[model samples]
Target: MFVYLWVLFGLFALHEDIVLRQHGIRFVFHGFALVNALVLAKVMLVAEDLKLGHRFQARPLIYQIVLEAFILATLFIAVHILEHTIGGLIAGETLAASVPSIGGGGMQGLFCVALILFVALIPFFGFRHISRELGPGRIKAMLFGRRESAAQAKPPV
Candidate 1:
């Protein structure tokens, strides 16, 4: 599962690199998608581990999952729209009718929801378990004038 998520991210990064190289633009919209996907995956995995959800059930848990999925979907679409608009602007090409239409209906909406859920669930179910099993460790840092031990200033005689 981790490999699959990384694969998806790698593919996006590759695609963005191609666009950057060919178009000579400093920005690639897919880069934003890649970052969002990482965060979304992490959040979903944590939520799932909380056992805050039940599959195919009409419980609050399920609803929360669905809502999170919805949020992911919106973010995905926003990434696409921003990418297309910017790409088009850079190339001096008018966006086609099929490109990033604001009022997409039915199938597109469903597809976005499904994509978001699938991506979100990957991290939610996988990482959450690992994170919980390996609890966050306390890391202490002594900086500035702080010292780990007071006993020893051996003179450099």
Candidate 2:
């Protein structure tokens, strides 16, 4: 989760840089991205322990994977809102003013952000489900173990 969030937030930082550069503002917030990733990673761990999206466990693996991703994405959106609101409150802003514009700044922006997050989470959940099914450490060995030689690959008569 940390790696995934770091990559996602890193891209956001890059995008922010490009947009700010266009407006003659010099800003770099990769550090903030790293911190955000760490916070979100912790949140993810907690959410997983709580089984935030276990409702689809009896359904297909894809269903669980997608549902979990959506759930986690929604949680991330909520966390972002809460974090910004708290920061605003700390800065002496009113509750109404403390609510930051999510996504780009409006409903559509929020939707876009949620969609991106959900999509990004898909691979993580997919791999996690696969790993679980494969048993602990099995996927790692399958992925990293040496391939069988041609002679060893042959089946016995």
Candidate 3:
């Protein structure tokens, strides 16, 4: 699961790199891509362990969706901020200057990243909830048409 999540982050990072390059920006993926992917994966693992959305299943589906989205988005945004802060330090700049360096995008970049992450995470996590109840092995079979042996499956919820 972490590998899959990291792959998605890599793709997203590539998209950002392409867009940034088109704008004549100095930003490139380099080592930052791997760092962001690993950090995002860790954030996701912690989020899953907390099960914030699953705790509120009695609410409307939209409510749960929003909660999960908010949590995931916040986690990702926090990591982005930290990454920027670290970059600022390495560049001998103030943390304030570095944190919002997305072309001085400031809060705008944070909001955009949060919204994009929210939308991206919905399918990953929404169906994950259903998959838990239905069994991971069953969901895998449903998705990939391959029978998963019990040993290869997650314990049912």
Candidate 4:
């Protein structure tokens, strides 16, 4: 949850730098703005499954991965479009003028965003599957690689 936000934030803010900061957008601490851009990502993707396919039905791993990736990428882009549209409306721009912004510098930029998101989602879903298998504590240790202090583990006398 928070980890996904952090990861996506890092990926977009650090890697996409100038692209993300376009249109007078300022880069802030810890990529909070980037995270905010995808705020619906956590809600729409994580809190509820996209249900692109059946869980009980057996399917190839690649099949599932592609499906999840496509759905996520589509919804992610849609959210961006909505944001841009609203911003445009607020600025008194017509829908025609606003709609083009969602294309994100044209198809190339849109593809780039989707590509970055697809790459980010790989680990997003990967860690989730791994977490289910190993449990969160182990996953935390694997990621952050830190153990509790001995003093924090012992019972008081």
Best by lDDT: 2
lDDT of 3 by residue, 1-157 (tens): 4665676677777887888889999686656657766778788788778776677788666677678878888877777778779978899997677875442477786577778778877877777666776876878789789668999998979
> Candidate 1: what lDDT?
0.54
Model 2: CA > 4 A from native = 22-24, 149-157
- For all predicted structures, in order, the TM-scores are 0.37, 0.89, 0.72, 0.63
Candidate 4: Cα lDDT at 130: 55
lDDT of 4: 0.66
Candidate 1: TM-score? 0.37
Candidate 2 differs from the real structure by a C-alpha RMSD in angstroms, to one decimal, of 2.1
- Candidate lDDT scores, in order, read 0.54, 0.91, 0.75, 0.66
The top-ranked prediction according to TM-score is 2
lDDT of 4 at 154: 66
Model 4 lDDT per residue over 67-153, tens place: 566677777678778877888999999987786543358888888778877776776666665576587588888668866688887
Weakest ten-residue segment in model 1 by summed lDDT: 136-145
Tell me the tens digit of each residue's lDDT in model 1 across 72-114: 4555465556767877877777767335554345677657555
Candidate ranking under TM-score, highest first, comes to 2, 3, 4, 1
lDDT of 2 by residue, 1-157 (tens): 8988899899988998999999999977689879999999999999989988898888889999999999999999999899999999999999999998887688999999999899999999999999998899988888898889888897878
lDDT of 3: 0.75
**Alpha-carbon error at 89 in model 2, in Å?**
1.0
Higher-lDDT candidate among 1 and 3? 3
